[model samples]
Target: MFQYYCGLRSGVKPNPSSKRSSFAHKISRFLKCCIYFFMSCIVFHGIIVLYGAPLIESVLETFLFAVLLSTFTTLNCLCMLGPNIQAWIRVFSKNGAMSIWDNSLQITTMCSIVGAWLGAFPIPLDWDRPWQVWPISCSLGATFGYVAGLIIAPLWIYWNRKQLTYKSR
Candidate 1:
């Protein structure tokens, strides 16, 4: 699982040429993920505030929601792709070519966004459940969406596996 999350697609051994290289690669990946995670947290907080989430009224809640949403949306991608911008663009750009990992990431992202949107629906209703608090529903929605994506994306990719392979031009 650790190897899978670190973007290792195969069971091949780490480059045995040098232990230093392996350690350095791990350190670099960690730093990159940390930087991206913090940046995403800040950006998501601002967007939530701007979306009429009560900047002063529920600041901490809003920030927490942002963190939660960011975790669902960005952490997985960072774990899988490790801040590679080209890989991000290629996977998200609606390109015809996509490996199973790429497809899973894209689907997960889409589901998270859609889940957050759907989670907002209960806010205005009269049910008045405890979970109706600002951002909570959305957070739950995004998490559920992420889980759904995790389950569905692989199966969908498996079903369409043949179509995903294409010869490089």
Candidate 2:
């Protein structure tokens, strides 16, 4: 019985090498995600407030507006670019490219909102000003960032590989 138990335990245990890499990779990814999220939030909030836009007059309205807008916008964008982005991500990761599309998209979207607020006339119920500018600019910026990432990723990967090869030699 003891021998059987030991055998079972060994079989159930994870491979130590893969476990270490998995943990390290998770930690690195998490740190990167945190930095990205923090920066995006700061930029988003700063732009909204800086533009003198009224802070959602009511708490419920603000919450609802944020939820609705985010959901709709995310869904729309995902519908348009979700597959392409996923494919690009897979290709870039496989090629060991330093693809910054994910990061840049977030940043540019935030920047667009800021730009909209700055450029738009902030009048409640006035669709002519802020609403019009924000989405258009955001979409344009998102596209620009994506295109930039594609161009930059290959160059970055090549440069890094060159550096590595040089150091190894």
Candidate 3:
């Protein structure tokens, strides 16, 4: 049992002279995929928000919210999935893995969504009538988003550490 546990942690040698699991390669690939996906999403979202069709500004705002929600949900699911994937890799490739962060990001994201919805000002996009609505709406929306992220980030970090400590015990 101890040897198996050690094997899972240390993993198998890569080459006859090197020590690294094939699982490490898979993990690197997965990380790369995630980075690519995240970057692409950022680029696409930025383009839609900044330079979308003039008439579609309102639609873009809503679509942005939906995309953010989906991303948050997906990341939350990944936190849960990590442990299972680690277990599978441990068995198949004799490599142990653990996720560093808990699923506290989900909570922060929910809180941010609620804050945005209930903020004193609402988000809007009116490119045609900039003087009429765009400035005020964008100002308020950006302020709300910034404040929400600030508040949620610390709480998330604290909650994550607390959960990790509790689980460790």
Candidate 4:
């Protein structure tokens, strides 16, 4: 199990295919996640600009919020997938085999995103607190949602993976 990610301890070398299971492969996924996170922020910014959201703050502040939001967004994006999404992406570009993620993963991910979005609801209420500022409440909500989803998804996956559904006349 450990060898899958860490590879050999000493002078032993690793094979090319085994590289996918290496530790570096798993951790490096974060780089792609960061890109997705940034894109998520960009979309949020576009909404803020177009609708003139009440959340008024400096660019840096908003960007901070975006970063936080992106952190979880990337997390949710990566949580579910058949193969390392990065690997799947590579295959897609090169026209190789396709990896399909099950519905459970998608369900888990959407729940995470929904959780983060719902985080914004607190800001509109009359509660008085420094963290109640624009993006702060929303970001908190997002984080909370992501955590909740992360905790619950395994159970969902466990239960879901066992069922086989069919429709017949």
Q: Pick the candidate with the highest lDDT.
A: 1
Ranking of candidates on lDDT, top first: 1, 4, 3, 2
TM-score of each candidate structure, all chains considered together: 0.81, 0.32, 0.37, 0.55
Q: Which has the greatest TM-score?
A: 1
lDDT of 4 by residue, 55-158 (tens): 55566666676666555544444554322666435433432323223333444445655875676677678979888877676667767776776677667656
lDDT string, candidate 3, 1-169, tens digits:
7545445556852353333565576687678547644654565455435643244556655455435533543444444454244443442342122233333443444454454344413324344554334233433443465467657666766767765566556
Order of the predicted models by TM-score, top scorer first: 1, 4, 3, 2
Show the colliding residue pairs in model 2.
Answer: none
Reference-based lDDT, each prediction: 0.83, 0.44, 0.47, 0.58
How close to the true structure is residue 47 of candidate 2, measured as C-alpha lDDT?
A: 49
What is the Cα-based TM-score of model 2?
0.32
Residue pairs with colliding backbones in model 3 are: none
Task: Write down the lDDT that model 2 would get.
Answer: 0.44
lDDT: worst 10-residue window of model 1: 160-169
Off by over 4 Å in 1: 1-22, 167-169
